[model samples]
Target: MVLHDLRKYSFWGLLSLAINLMYTKIIFPCALLVRRPAHIRILGSYSIGRGFTSGPGLILDVLNDNAELLIGSNVKLNHRCHIGVMKSVKIGNDVLFASNVFISDHTHGSYIGDMQSNPLQPPNEREIVCGNVEIGDKVWIGENVAVLLGVSIGESSIIGANSVVTKDIPAFSIAVGSPARVIKTWDKAVEKWVAVS
Candidate 1:
């Protein structure tokens, strides 16, 4: 652990940290910290509150001028987390995201709408269908999780690793698995998480 810490805090690491400080203060004044080497392409707008920090390789993409992404204060996102917004994505305060997590508010083509994109067309060339995603405060999203379009993750919830959240997760719950389901919910009186029976 000590050796790993030393390697992580090496000269290049320190330089990256310094550059991030400048980037936050000057370039992106909304965020308190954004680690360097992040692939951020925001044609739209985003507002991140103070004490927002992200690890290296954080990818934030806002595809169009109408898109908006809002993140509250003291949110921490680990390495390689990607958030792609086409309409709106609001993340509340004190949220945590583990590595390789993806949160997107849009998909390549419309499946439910009448004006669907051509199936013969490439996905990259297809029209984008927009949605909205809202993540409440004090939510802990585990590694490799994908929070899909039009989903809402309520406050004080935990999403297990490798899960794909396709629907709304109620507050004070523990959800897991692909197409994530609420496996347990917090019982305040018992002060424990009781399994969904």
Candidate 2:
């Protein structure tokens, strides 16, 4: 009875190890290829650090040759996170992102011209406004969050769900709402987060 039980446990352990090997060696690489097909004209130049794990449906769109996307170590990105890099995107270590997070450093339509002048033109043909996005370490961005062009999110900052980050968020701040504003900031003197007026 003891030998039988030991064999059963060993079989299950071996099966688990085989599955992990398949996932790391074959499944993950195939998933990346399927998610980003060769026909897509996205040129990606990524400098990723160790311990980076991304869930399914990760899309990396690099619009230009000079575009760069740098992700630091120990970062976790949830499913369907789209990173559109037109200039540069620098993400620091230990950052966690929830599902459907979109970080882009460019805007698709031309803001200078009149809306009705070339309204029928395709969006892809329109001019792109490019900038750089910098996200510091230990930042947490919630689901459906969109970090727009030229925004910098500082270290230890928490961006609430569905927030549209349009500007710079200071370090140790808690920001929420559309066009996210800092609702709370860490006060070192008080050793706690204080409300921002």
Candidate 3:
């Protein structure tokens, strides 16, 4: 009875290991929206590096052939994170994104006129305004953050929760608020982060 139990345990362990390997190697590479190792949905194109991990409900949408979404190694994207790339979006290595973060490099229609006037025309049919978004290495983006078009986030920066990033964030800085102001920056001389006076 002891020997039979040992064999059963070993067989189950091997089966689990095989499933994990298949999910990581075969399924993840082919799937567009990956909910888990086994569950995935087709959506967009991704140029991802090694050791990329994402939680449930990640949306990656590449609009056209010119659109490119490049994610570097060891990046972790938490639940319900949406990344829409109409032009280009380059994310560097070791980046951590919390839940409900939205990053988009394009906007629907030109900022010329109000859309309420034309009720018949669908918004999706309008022209898209696109730009490139570049995020450097070791950046941590908190929950409910929205990163807009043409923004460049420098290395080792921290984006606070519920912030809207409309402009560039400098390296080693902590930014917060609606426009995402730089509230603090890492002072290399002091070996710590200092508040902006």
Question: Relative to the true structure, how large is the alpha-carbon lDDT of every model?
Answer: 0.91, 0.80, 0.82
- Candidate 1 lDDT by residue in tens digits, 83-159: 99999999999999999999999889887757878889999988777779999999999999999999999999999
Off by over 4 Å in 3: 1-21, 29-34, 37-45, 112-121
Models sorted by lDDT, best on top: 1, 3, 2
Q: Which ten residues in a row have the lowest lDDT in candidate 1?
A: 1-10
Q: What TM-score would you give candidate 1 relative to the actual structure?
A: 0.88
Report RMSD (Å) for each prediction in the order shown: 3.2, 6.3, 6.1
Instruction: Supply candidate 1's per-residue lDDT for 12.
Output: 82
Local distance difference test, candidate 2: 0.80
Clashes in model 1: which pairs? none
lDDT of 1: 0.91
Better-scoring candidate (TM-score), 1 or 3: 1
TM-score ranking from best to worst? 1, 3, 2
Better of 1 and 2 by lDDT: 1
Error of 1 at 93 (Å): 0.4
Better of 1 and 2 by TM-score: 1
Cα lDDT tens digits for candidate 2, 40-85: 2357677666666666677777777888888888788888888989
